[model samples]
Target: MSDALTLKAMLRPKFRGALLGVAVGDALGFPFEGSSHSFMAALGPDALHAFEAHRSGYFPPGQFSDDTQLTLATVESFLQEKRFSGKSLAESFLPLWRENRIIGRSPGCSEAIERLIDRTADWRTSGCEEGRAGNGAAKRMVPLGLWNYDEPERLVEEATLAAEITHRDRRAVAGAVAVAASVAYSLTRRDLILGEWIDAVAGATAPISPALARHFRDLPRFLSMGEKEAVAAISKLGYDDPATAPTTLVTPFVVPSVMTAFFWFLRHPDDWRETVGGCLRSGGDVDTIASIGGGISGAFNGIEAIPEALRETVVDRDRLIDLADRLHTLKEAVRSRRGA
Candidate 1:
């Protein structure tokens, strides 16, 4: 095959792998979200050992909550028009909400989605307040990145619009931009070094919020702090703390958690078990962290990089993979048209 065809072939599998990795990681970590590291450790002989999915609080095990559901909804909207649209996304989201796939115990997301359904609230203004910067929107944006792999700028723009459908906060938008950029960067580079990929994401996201800028700037310092110390530094900022500014809290916790997971994956690039385990051991925002880490790791290593047991157990695995394949086709079509 020609170099172009080889690259194209690789893109599809990477995109599929990345999306499935996110869902698998999310489902794995879903059962232990609020539990402490010790509590999680007590469940198995090793950190990544399989355990029964939690059924107490929200959705059932092997069933995705808002994270995977909203992601699928966004993918469905993208499929309808080959692009992201806030109105279309809101339309897509309502059906998921009606089906009870988007339910979570998070009050912020619940209220936002409810108001969006009533049409009483503008999706554009729904999360403008500083305190609305949760990881909800960012966690579901991996597909946007994959769909526009050759166009980092467009990926960021489309991701911002997709995020604004329910999370209009600048921090939320910035987080989506960062994650999308990371995926886009991963797709374009064939032999990406870990640090270079991180730098590429930082550069692509430079135009966003200053809070994100500072996090990227300090990323190396935090990386040097070791995983335990890094988690400690992040925990000091607290999660959903009403006292701290929303931007500040999210910047410290969400970004650091995601970055730390990526860093650990980079350190253990060839070891899927260790990479996902390190993400699970990171302590807070477990699902989001593992999802991001898994996406990056899967992109670099391909779908075969993910463990078969986890992949087989992923909720909606076939649908997610099909969506990813569709997104990859859209990406190539757009690239071809632009070349014409």
Candidate 2:
């Protein structure tokens, strides 16, 4: 196959893999969101089992949460506009918020999007100072990276715009930049060493947040800290009380959660089951962690790398696949127009 064909072939599977991987990871971790690791350990070998062991009524077994829902919306926006635009993002995001039933239940997220829709506040200055930096921004950034896979700088720029729609805080933007950069780097280069990939992400995200910039700068040292210790270290970097200080507390959680997930996938590159499972087992912000991990792994391994059972169970799998294809087409359109 020609290089172009090879690159295009890689796009479909990575796109499908990234979205489906997120759904699978989200569903796997949904049942244990607030539960402690010890409680999960009490469940025996299959500690990270599906919803059968943990009940979430109305939500189907493999259904995703706000993470995948927002991601889908972002992908849809890219398809509609062929490039990232804050106004277009807000237009696309509000409907998904209502359509996915994310409002009321997820107050922080709902409030953010609602404000954008109502024009009560500009996305650039709307985030709550007390709002904890949950993984909300990072969870939805895969599409930005996937949409501009060939242009790492554009991926970072677009991902930052997508993130600002809901999370305008510096920390929130930093987390999105890191994840998006990772995805873009993974997509463009096949032979990247894991540490080198992490470094590249850190470098790309340097302008977003000093804390995040520092975190990425020293990531090589942290990589040896092991998953549990690393998570604990990350959790400590900020208060986890989302209700008390939403932005201040949450930013800490998202940075480490995204980093931990990326590292987990790096450690287990070939095993999708273990990679996704390790993300679930990492605890605290389970869905977000898994979403990040799944996206990275899926980007590196492709759709076929994901398990058959998990892939089949993703809510709206066909629709997500179609969306990915549409995003790819839009990307090509943008490239063609720019060349013209």
Candidate 3:
């Protein structure tokens, strides 16, 4: 096969799956963003099947939130520059904020973009650094994973630049590295070994945050527990309180959100519905959690693994697939130049 065909044959579906997975999961969990664990759990098995928007009609069904908006913004910058540009990426986020179109915008992300738009901070200095470790940066990093698949060092560097635009806390940057690295690993492997995957992500993360690395390493132990015990343990990742509530929802804090996504993805690696739906029911930042989990599972499982109904209903389904194709094309070009 020609170079183009070979790369396409190997990567197109995975790219499509990863990007589409993020959007579909975001759309599916958007309705339950602030819902508590008890509320989501009370819905039981039906929660897995439910995919829609918030009831206020603020967003129609199938629309995604800022999690996906950021991802698309990242991809658009890469496509235009043919490489990651922190300035361009920062600029891309501005229109969303200026137009008042960003749904479910987190405070950290809102402040970062606001500063950039007002010229109070440049791309390098704009990140919310006052111990802000939200998952905003990590959730939109799948494109960096796709772009830097064969360049681990470059991947880390670019992931940092991409993340620090809105999240400068080292822990938050570590979370971004973990998510993007996981996607790269997923694309490279035909089959996933849970322990090996965890080790790889942990190794990549440790250089930035040992605490987050420890959390990644601890995932396998949680895997050994039954679902209820596992959810209880994982849900407490970033918190100190011992809860009396029926369940504790996963928060937007980087540690718990990333761990929750990883836990669910590990639990149901081969089942698309289970992986993302499990994140959905974990509650709290449901959209971001499921979107992260969905990206990993989709990269591993490919586009065909996602349910047809969800694919049909997700906002910007066609645009996401097109972005994937463009990313794949760019990946092939970059790899060919590097002789990778």
| TM-scores for the candidates | 0.87, 0.86, 0.94
lDDT of 2 at 183: 77
Residues 1-340 of candidate 2: C-alpha lDDT, one tens digit per residue: 9887787677777777777777777777666675554454455447444443236476666767777877787877777776777777777777765566661135556778778777788766555443456667788888878777777777778787777766766777788888888777766655658668767888778877777777766666666777566555554553456345332111225666776677677667766677777766656667777778888788777888877766776678789778867776677777788882
lDDT at residue 143 of model 2 (Cα atoms): 80
Which lDDT value does model 1 have at 125? 62
Steric clash pairs (candidate 3): none
Query: Judged by lDDT, which candidate is best?
Result: 3
Model 2, runs deviating above 4 Å: 1-5, 41-54, 103-105, 123-125, 129-132, 238-252, 336-340
Q: lDDT value for candidate 3? A: 0.87
What value of lDDT does candidate 1 attain over all alpha carbons?
Answer: 0.69
Off by over 4 Å in 1: 1-3, 43-47, 57-61, 103-105, 237-253
- Candidate 3, residue 196: how far the Cα is off, in Å: 2.0
What 10-residue stretch in candidate 2 is worst by lDDT? Answer: 243-252
lDDT of 1 at 123: 71
Runs in model 3 deviating more than 4 A are 1-8, 240-247
Q: Is candidate 2 or candidate 3 better by TM-score?
A: 3
Among the numbered candidates, top TM-score falls to: 3
